[model samples]
Target chain A: MDQTSSSFVGFAGLASKNKEATKMKAKRRKKISGADLAFRICNGIFMVLFVIITLYPVLNTLAVSLNDGTDALRGGIYLFPRVFTWKNYETVLSKDNLITGAFITVARTVIGTLLALVMNAILAFIVSRKNFIFAKPVSLFWVITMYVNGGLIPTFLLFKSLGLTNSFAVYVIPGMVSAFNMLVIRTYMRGIPDSLEESAQLDGAGYTTIFLKIISPLCKPVYATVALFVAVGQWNSWFDAMLYNRMASQYTTLQYELMKLLSSVSNQSSSAEAMKNAGEGSVTPTSVRAAATIITMLPIICIYPFLQRYFVTGLTLGGVKE
Target chain B: MKTKAINMVDLKRQKVLIFWAAAITIYGIIFNYLPLAGWLMAFQNYKPVTGLLHSQFVGLAKFKLLFSDVSFLRVIRNTLAMGVINLAVTFFMAILFAILLNEMASKGGKKVVQTISYLPHFLSWIIVTGILHDALSGTGIINTLLLHFGAVTQPINFFAHEKYFWPIVAFANVWKETGWNAIIYLAAITSIDPSLYEAAAIDGAGRWAKIKHVTLPGIKPTIMILLLMNVGNVLNAGFEIQYLLGNGLVQNVSQTIDIYVLKWGISQGDYSIGTAAGIFKSVVAIVLIVICNHLAKKHGEERLF
Candidate 1:
């Protein structure tokens, strides 16, 4: 990525050959010399300050999630753990904290992302084909969707009609194809130079073979981009879980499980009725929510940077065809 | 080739398209477009059992209620306020991070920062809020830090404070997406021709000037396109973050239209009003997109259409 090595390469390149020319300019720069120095110093300070202010709360939260709840409440922890104990984690990991709920979350995320990719891939490829007569209408359909959506109640009722109101499919099926992902993909596939298909045809390859062996492999950036979106969408999603999963025993994703736990904790400190229900069987509201959220975030966070590299290419030069 | 061309792709052989399109359109029809019928409920005194047509039409009564209601007014204000803050913070932080990463000069450093920053984007709001809850609680890490630094005598109870709520929301947004958002800018930066930088440097232009002129102008189209596209999402200030981070203490400031629809429409079973709110959001989104597109066209920027 540093095409010819370190910053030193660029810096030295900027310095020596251009020294006298830089010095002549430096005299002019020296006119506001102190001010320029002040400006640069200010820019440096502000940048660091911004990063800290932006990152501190999140880091603090991470520290809290790792801290003992009782000690965390007592204000004993700051910057680092005062009482470094895995008790909160142990409390969370125990099945008493609704381990089945965690399983349901993992299942939903895996199943939902996979289904979304499959649905989007199939449609995108079809839409990508040059002579596909229905492509215009299909693409228009996706475009209009980006602007307007029917509200939640109708969507809920729509899911209910399909008997998805309480089931895991409610979360997975309705959201299978995002318009953004579809369009980006269609834009990408359109780039495959129709001659590739012609050449494939000359070699006697069928459309299916062309798509599988050629198009899919060629569109790696879009594939990675779409996969990341689906994964993130499924991972961070608990609202649907809350909306559909009205029962405590129902399959709750990690997000919903954490929500159920946190809300219960707040409800406990806030309401006696809620407190009575707190830390009860199949739900250790306090520690489990923390654990579930951390656990659910693990895969996405882990995969993010690698995916981000491809994501950059996907956004930048990736859409050259469309 | 002649034999295959003569045989052609008959409908029978087009089973792949048929099966796949059928599978997805079945999804689209049921989940996406079919919900349009629910908009009719906004005009009806809707009952689930009686269904759409049979439900008595109540005209613009719900919309009237929405206009006159103080809560509705508050909802709009809250939505706009948070939405603007979220947009500004996310936009700037993303650009800022992209600039910083550009300066880092080491691939490993860029990769590490990119990884740390993007991790949050994947976590559930449930997890993020949980983390914030413990961090910002009365006796939490934030208070402890401030107390240690003597910034204040005690923890400010961040989640409950109305003033802190929006800032927290904005910061949370920046945390989750600033890096992810920067990827677009970084991409745009990479597209900036190296020759332009060389020319600028030949004239002895410093790093800052090069960025202001060369890099910034180069990315202006990308920025403008993204801005127009994002105009449609202004009303979508996000639901999960505000819902989870905000409590009664900050409810006035935190309750956006989406949450209002959730409370009055869904939670309480008022489908008509919920649909009305939904219709309101859809209308605003459409209007924003149209206006932004029109404005982009007028300015001769790349039009989304």
Candidate 2:
């Protein structure tokens, strides 16, 4: 079975240089024929339509999130808000649960990404080391995890036995050493010039020093790529939160909170009434839910442009190298 | 004697590396390997109080119950139905999107569209489902547009019906994943020799002709390989979307094996039966993967080991 889809991209660039060359060769400019011109015009229009179809939901959600809750229910909210208001956002943020959930989510993303990167990088380096005595066995041990597992129940039971279930540690521990990530990091590390490390070794540098100073710096692109993948994954993930910390509301992540909020949308009116009574603002559950959805996605959307280059490079490498 | 002394120094140097390796190895064993032993619970009437050891041995009873249970059978059907729908829709949409995106004359258009498209893939399913709920609601844009255009006199309560569940799920999946999935195919297309197009152009082949002849053929291997690999995932009908979107009205159609496992194993405390369902899913998945891998190798296509 596949590991997390994002992690696959991290280590997928081992042989991308050859593929990259092919792509370069394919980039020669050419002229278009009349028929080709006609086809492209139609195709371009079709693609624009496709883009609108794809983007409309997000835009509509934004519209709904911005619209006054009562006005939103009257219908005809399209690209823009009918009765614009920030009350939806105010209601969503004003909820105490959102704050705690956001804290858990932020904490997990930072700590989980750091732990996974550092530990997986170390393991990848160790296994990629040609002269390491345990390299083959260690690689095999991790590789097997990519293909098989003992299923969810046993894994849950294992965590339960270890007293990890419902604890903050459960979020951080199981994800600490991803086999797929290790492979990706190892592949990138393998591409670095061994001479860089060998010369350092001869200069009386230890393995730790060589890894930290030489290989890690050279593999920054892959590291950044993998780090983004891990961070996005950690932020988007709710299953582990639901599974491990189901009993504890304080430990639930924001995604899980949003999931609960969305699920309970069936009883929106009652919740809306409760919120109306609890606060001065009059916000409908539907608008508040949309606001919560926007809040949940805002972090990724904000960082996406800055990190977009990494995603493109990472995905291209993942696709071509595979 | 000097070589022996050098070997000892090398061994000392590797002690730290070995120590780190040991630490990760221990983690792997506990997290991954230890679960294999828990499969024994499937063969026993496992009570959490008694645990695996003191539980009564009941060979194949849970499996028997699973086979006999009508609900489990329905869950299997729902799983297969949704899985096939997901695979078929997502597979085609991704390929078609990639092909069309590749055909665009403007590189900027392609890049911008691709960027905007895969952004949804990054959003958690929670948010996606929330958006879906709003969009598919009676007063939402979809129904509102339909009514405005006189397509229908009344709004279609989409979620209130069970028949729309699989298709809605599949559409949501395609919407979220098409761009991300297309990236692989686009990469394959990029790596296709441009000279093929140059040759076709010299032969008076049109853009469509070039696409049919050169581009499609170029990515055929990728399509075949990915399709074959996805055969193993027939059981993963997706838990999050189904669980979140599904309600009491749609329970019969929405319950997949994972949901079944959660319902029985954790929620209701029928651990043995849940474990049995889990074990069953694993065995079937392993078999499907091996068979698919073997078939890919037999056909001389790219095979994932």
Candidate 3:
């Protein structure tokens, strides 16, 4: 658990050490040998190529989405739009299902992330208490849920029986308390000093007061990390939308709509029908699909910078179990 | 008297904790443990009309049916093949990418590259698959590049071919997850004592030598733990990607156990067989995880439990 502190120091120290190493090796540059230089050059080139390969498809999709739908089918559109127009976007945005889907996606992301954060944090706080009698059993109870569970059919049947199907609750309730998330938050909470809680308790503060006042504030970083995880998961999740709410168009999600659009474009006959249904002969399935794809991914891409900042901490905290 | 007083105070303090625990415990049983009761459906000829209690008992029949079915067997094969391939390739590439990124001289350049690389990861599978379809389509960049490079006489329909399906899925996974997966390994690498690298450098070890001796061994524990964790998930080859990308042409290779369960359980309405398949998968997952944990313990490495 303390590896995080040492790792940060290591990273900070390495950057300066690298500068010193380069300076010390400057005179030995001639003796460095062509092999090492070649490796460095190749590695640099490889990183560049890797970045390009990673970004090309995304940028290409953007180009296709922006290009005239009919012109995009001509097919050499790579980096930039050939015949630029927002018609494809307009068409995708204009779809009634997509609009409703976007609303559902946003609502679920907001409500689910907030609820899961509070619930998981509360559980983490309880288990994190040093003197709590039920802490061990409670932790074990949730931890066991991580390893074994009912499979999809059983889970689906359970949800169906509970009348969660075709409802918005299906999106948030079943996933309310992720065992992995609880573990991550618990791990972070355990790192907090016990004296803080002890001092708070001596001040006549109750467990809930200490948790809400002292523990929660100190745990902001972990909360941010877990919030990003839950938000991204909620936004990106389509399987639930497809599984439980497929017949309920009112509860459709953005990802599900994109999935539908994707499948329509993938299948030949439906793609032709989709092409005609666009009502404008200029808008093809390819462009519409690309536009919808871009739209679906827009929120994630927008928040990715923020996600990147917290994810490493979250991942490492969850990853290294002792 | 003092001990009893302390016990009473402890019990009083436990009141709030007990309420919280009770709430979560109830939610846990309902959501996590309760669904497991539905496993009984696997042993019966389940019918929606009659329900689980009244359904006729049929012992081991659905499991037998699954084993005897060729498609079920093929689905298992596909699931294992894709899962193993994805696991191997993504694991190797993440390690390799972390090492490569570590070797870069420019810190800013490394950060930029890493950021761009993982951009695909946050996108939903639907979007990733959509990008895959667009990129691998006949008129797409892959075929265009192949045509331009004289690799093929004409454009190739990548999705329609069976031989290409597994590789395509593997590649998509690698592209989507390599950077994200590397984050853990990168953290591991960062934690490697700087003294080790200094010692290696003093020994006149080259870049490759340092990577081999210091970096690889430094991250060995992390790698082992992650590998063990993934072993339990080998059956989760993935449902969304396979289901989304699969078509009539490539259905045989593309269908995993999940899709098989979905087809049988939901679409086809064979609840008994679907439950049987689900049970088999869950059993295998738990068994694999327990075995891996045991092996890790014996080997004196990190055990997941």
List chain A TM-scores, every candidate, in order: 0.80, 0.84, 0.89
What's the C-alpha lDDT at position B121 in model 3? 86
Error of 1 at A221 (Å): 4.0
Which runs in model 1 stand beyond 4 Å of their true positions? Answer: A1-67, A268-288, A317-322, B1-15, B105-107, B148-150
- Candidates ranked by DockQ: 3, 2, 1
lDDT of 1 by residue, A198-271 (tens): 79877988778887899889988788778877777777787887887666456676666677778876655632
CA lDDT, candidate 1, residue A32: 42
In order, what lDDT does every prediction score?
0.73, 0.82, 0.88
Q: Which candidate is the best by lDDT?
A: 3
If the candidates were sorted by their lDDT against the true structure, best first, what order would they fall in? 3, 2, 1
Those runs of model 3 whose alpha carbons end farther than 4 Å from true positions after fitting are A1-31, A269-277, B1-6
Which residue pairs in candidate 1 collide? none
Residue range B1-305, candidate 2, lDDT tens digits: 22423376777999889999999899899888989888999999898899988999999999999999999999988988899889999999999999999886544455567777778888998888888888888778889889989999989978878998998999999989998889888888988999999999899888788989999999999898788767788886568889888888889998899999999988898888998998888788879888988888898988776
Q: What is candidate 3's lDDT per residue for A1-322, written digit by digit as tens? A: 2233333346557657777776687767647578978998899899988988899999999999999987776778999999999999999888899999999999999999999999999999888877777888999989888877888888998899899999999999889998899989999998988889888888999998998899999889899999999999999999999999999999999999888888777775544565576668789878888988888788788767645658888998998554
TM-score of chain A of 1: 0.80
User: What's each prediction's TM-score?
Assistant: 0.87, 0.91, 0.94
Q: What share of the true interface contacts does each candidate keep?
A: 0.53, 0.64, 0.71
- DockQ of all predictions against the true structure, Cα-based: 0.41, 0.49, 0.58
| Pairwise TM-score winner, candidates 2 and 3 | 3
